[model samples]
Target: MRLAGAIDIGGSSTKLGIVAEDGSIIRRDSVPTSLHGEPMVVVDAIVASLQPMLDAGGTEGKPVSGIGVSVAGFLNRDHSAMVHNANLPALHDFPLRQSLKERLGFDCRLEVDSNAAVVAEYQYGAGRGSARLLGVTMGTGLGGGVIIDGKLLRFTGECAGDLGHIIVDHKGRLCTCGARGCLEAMVNSASLSERAGGRAVREIITSAREGDQLAMTALAETGWWLGLGLASLSPIFSPDRIVVGGGIAAAGELILEATRASYRTHARPEFREKTQVVGSSFEGWEGIVGAASQFLNPIA
Candidate 1:
């Protein structure tokens, strides 16, 4: 069976895994991320964490054909390294692709996190049959990607040009990307935490699942802004399906119901009926799945 190694580097954590050709994950784990801007430290940690899995199946042959990396930022012109990301400043301009290959002794390729998320959904999750798919991942920051007729919408910088940076409210909040009222700033984990009394995002999602009123309210508010943001994006992509993934989406319907309501309220009539918003089947691990797909189910 063919296999691939994958890594998804985020603002708060790094996810690594082994994946098979049919889109099934063989191993999955995560490590804490640092904000101290030490690029090599992060890469070293990832290499160490992934070594065991790679060696576990080594007796058979090359354990994995190669590794794919997903990073949250604007990639360099040649898709070499992440050059910009407000949430993950440590890896900015870091030679992530080369470093991984050197340390792990395997081919490595970089993919924008947003692109990875959409590719995962399109290939093996909620977006399998979609003619047009738009996937959004809400975490330390917001990111999105698009697919049309099974091809990536890579118009600029390896993705849909920072969908999170779009302005949804001109006077709402300041974004890490230095913009005022960016959709991400308004609907990100920080804003959600603010509404939930400063609790961590995982805690808020857990509390909401346990029927905590305040937690529910916080997610609802975040979902509202998220819906507005999706509605704002509706006209451009006009997707048949919109898949929501990431930490915040763990609330499932608690967040999606509200997001759907707000989206319907704001979206045009034709779009309201045609577009179907759904949650990702991969939960928070879609990026890793897509990253692995670079080897398992490559899409240009």
Candidate 2:
């Protein structure tokens, strides 16, 4: 069976994996992202970590067809380089695809991390049959992707699906992107932690599960913001399904119930009954899976 090599580069760490056609990760590893070093240094580290897995495939007689990289940044129109990334300063305008291809001797494809994840959902997860799907990843910030008519939507400068910066409030919380009341500012993990009196999100989730009123309220508030954001998008996209992912989504109904309620309260009556919100099918590895799939079937 043919395989694909996948890399998901996040703010804190980078994940490397060899994936089968069915979205199963046959082998995986990770390394901390060296933000202060040159971009090539980080790429070299990833290659070192993945070398073993690549060699193992030789013995198994499964040659990797290509490598796909999912990056948490904006990609140039051609997708050969990262134009900007707040989390990894060293990677700004970096020629990621060329560097990887030179070092790994395989065709390499680069994609925005959120877009990759949404592709994973649309192709293999909860969004398998939806005509229009909106996938959201809630973590340090909100990231989004849209798939319509069985194709990924692309906009000017490749910025079509950046739903995080949508202004949800005019005079609400400040966002890292220098915007006021962005959906990301209102519903990110940092805001949730702040709502829980500076406790970690994990602690708040644990407390909420233990019947702590404050913790539950905090999650509910975040969900409210998330729902309002979804409501705002519903009229424009009219997505049939919205899949929420990332670490924070693990809270399940503690947060999702409030999200549903808020969406119902704010969405148009016509849309209210049509749209459905659900958690991700893949845990935290959707980006990796999607990256691998990109190699098998390149989206146009």
Candidate 3:
């Protein structure tokens, strides 16, 4: 069986995996992303981590046919390089695809992380069978992607799914993007942590799971904001389903119920019953699985 090597580069960590054609991860590993270093430093580290997996043909004995990368940045028109990434400043304008090709000796595919994630969902997860799908991932920040009639939507800037920067509240909170009340600033991990009394998002989630009032309240508030953002976008896209994923989404219905409530309240009345908000099927590995699949069967 043929496989694809996958890499998902995020703000805090990078995930590396070898994936089979059916979206099963054959082997996986991760490394902390160096926030302050040359872009190639992190690249070298990823290459080192992936080398063994590539040579071994992975756990399923599948030879990798190519490589795919899901990155948290704006990809250029042809997806050859990262045009910009506020979280990983060092990678701005970096020729990531070329670099990886030279080091790994395989054809490489590159995609915005959120776009890759939605592709995974569309092909194998929650968005299956939907003609219009919108997928949102909330991690260190929020990301989104859209699929219309089974085709990935690509706009002029190639940033069509950058939902984090959408303004949810005009005077709400300061965002990393230097904006106030952006959806990301209102509902991202940082906001959750702050609401949970300086605790990490993971801790807050655990506390919420254990029925801690404060943690639950924080999650609810975050979900409210997230719903508002989704509601605002609903009229424009009218997605059949919206799948939410990320570390924070582990809170499950503690967050999703509130999001559904708010979306229903704010979205156009006609759209309220049309769209469904649910959790992702791939858990937190959607980006990796989707990236790998893009390498083997690319969307036209």
For model 2, how does the per-residue alpha-carbon lDDT over 274-300 read when each residue is reduced to its tens digit?
999988887767888889888776665
Candidate 1 residue pairs that clash: none
After superposing candidate 1, which stretches have Cα over 4 Å from the reference?
60-62
Worst 10 residues of 2 by lDDT: 153-162
Judged by lDDT relative to the true structure, which candidate is superior, 1 or 2? 1
Tens digit per residue, CA lDDT, model 3, 1-300:
678999999887899899888888889998988876898998998999998999887454667989999998789988898876667787888889999999999899998888888888888888899888999988888988899997888773464656788898999889888889999899988899889888988799889999999999999999999999999988777898999987788788999999999999999887798899999887678889889988666764
> How many angstroms is residue 247 displaced in model 2 relative to the true structure, after the best TM-score fit?
2.2
The lDDT for every candidate, in the order shown, is: 0.91, 0.85, 0.87
lDDT of 1 by residue, 121-207 (tens): 999999899999999999999999999998998877778988998999889899988889999998888999999999999999899
TM-score of each: 0.98, 0.92, 0.96
TM-score pick, better of 1 and 3: 1
152 Cα displacement, candidate 1 (Å): 0.5
Best by lDDT: 1
Candidate 2 stretches with Cα past 4 Å from truth are none
Candidate 2: RMSD to truth:
2.0
